[model samples]
Target: MLNTGLLELHSDCQNCFGLCCAALPFAASSDFAIDKNAGQPCPNLRNDFRCGIHTELRAKGFRGCTVYDCFGAGQKVSNLTYGGRDWLQAPETAGQMFEVFPVMRQLHELLWYLREALAFRGAESLHDSLKLMLEQTLMLTTLSPEELLKLEVHIHRAEVNELLLRASELARSTARGQLNPAPKRQKNYGRGADLIGAKLRQADLRCVSLRGAYLIAADLSGADLRHADLIGADLRDTNLSGADLRDSLFLTQAQLQAAKGDLAAQLPGSLQYPEHWSVKL
Candidate 1:
């Protein structure tokens, strides 16, 4: 099982310096209400570093903020990297801090995935390698702002992803055997498949690799998606009512927010149901 303590690595906005609301620039689009430049405090960001309209973000056309997760990067940079000094308190260091935040966020995201991969008992063969990579990634998160700015996070991510993919293959292959003991062949669920508007209601997708699949507006109501690798899957407007996704891999809060689900839809413990979901149950 995943170490429950690792959950602390997730975003805790209360402990952050509102980096996401300030450092990341967003264009005025369907997802955001306004175009904001990088390093500029969001108009809705309060003096206390909290969103002024957090509760009504989606209703107020700031749905992008509702989906953003920094994986505890904000607090790590705010407290540890800068000794709890905020941008306003020390203007000289603000630029460097802002630049470091995104780098830390990417590293933390990789840590999240590696930690999840460590929980798979079926992937015991890759555990040692995963642990080593996790340690290396965690170390990167602790680097100084200057060091972080110099780091190439994508290169490190590529190295870690190799082990994660192997682990996923092992776990999914094992889950496939356990879930379907029969020798019946399954269709190739292609990577990056353009599954837009595909009707997949009640589909047996257990242990399938749906990585990078375009599931936009797909009708997946009541689909059995347990153990499916959903990394980078575009779930916008996908109907997941009554679907089982308890063991889905690499599924993130942003993807869930972009999709629609109900109380009857089973999600993994790491993810929460979006409040905007229309169906009660």
Candidate 2:
């Protein structure tokens, strides 16, 4: 298996420009009660790039802000990539930074899963391909600012399709036969089942009905969860590292985003990495 420990690298956020304050948007929801547009600095953002009402964001109707994470993307681009520059003084650099930020974020997210995939013993068969992909992705980070901004990630994704498919097979195989399909039963009955601390590592749980199940602190590492239905499931502190959650049903953006996963972590394909994690190594 590939070593994923090295992919846990992070940037010092204190020196960052608080890009998350500017890059992300908010909608009126349980987490965020206000609507903010992209590229607009959050009202609570101070001149020093700290949230003025950080401690009271939840009380002040901005609970979403407290849970949001840039996955260290804010720091990586705001600090190392740009040498601590900001759009404030250098307005001309704003466009470039904005374009590069998302790209870098995606790369970092990919790094998270690639690293995690390598760490899974069940994925050993595809280690060589994983290594190549990881190295190539590492090289992308070194591309020129213009090149990085203009990178055609779709092409790279296409190139790795085979590897991803193979890795999925390997990862899925590890979870063989753990979960049985339940009869098409009434929804209200399964509202709150106790699944905490279940030894469900590497289990194939795709398309399983787990709505409103108490999955708190479940050992779900390396589980194949593509297209599974997980609406209203309590997933606090769940160990979902390296688990495939792409296309999983009923997983709202708010729930998945609020859930915690390490950099070198994986989520359903439908989910995006929380901005706070630096890289998914």
Q: Which candidate number maximizes TM-score?
A: 1
Tens digit per residue, CA lDDT, model 2, 181-269: 53233223254778887778888777565757888778887776664557557776577777778745445444554555655665555
Residue runs of model 1 more than 4 Å from their true location after superposition = 1-7, 180-184
lDDT of each: 0.87, 0.66
Cα error, residue 260 of model 2, in Å, equals: 11
lDDT of 1 at 280: 54
What range of 10 consecutive residues in model 2 has the weakest lDDT sum?
Answer: 182-191
Q: Once superposed on the true structure, which residue ranges of model 2 sit more than 4 Å away at CA?
A: 1-12, 158-162, 175-281
- For each candidate, give its TM-score against the true structure: 0.93, 0.61
- On lDDT, the candidate that comes out on top is 1
Q: How many pairs collide in each candidate, listed in order?
A: 0, 19
Lowest-lDDT window of 10 residues in candidate 1?
1-10
lDDT, candidate 1, residue 13? 92
* Model 2 Cα shift for residue 58 (angstroms): 2.9
Per-residue lDDT of 194 in model 1 = 94
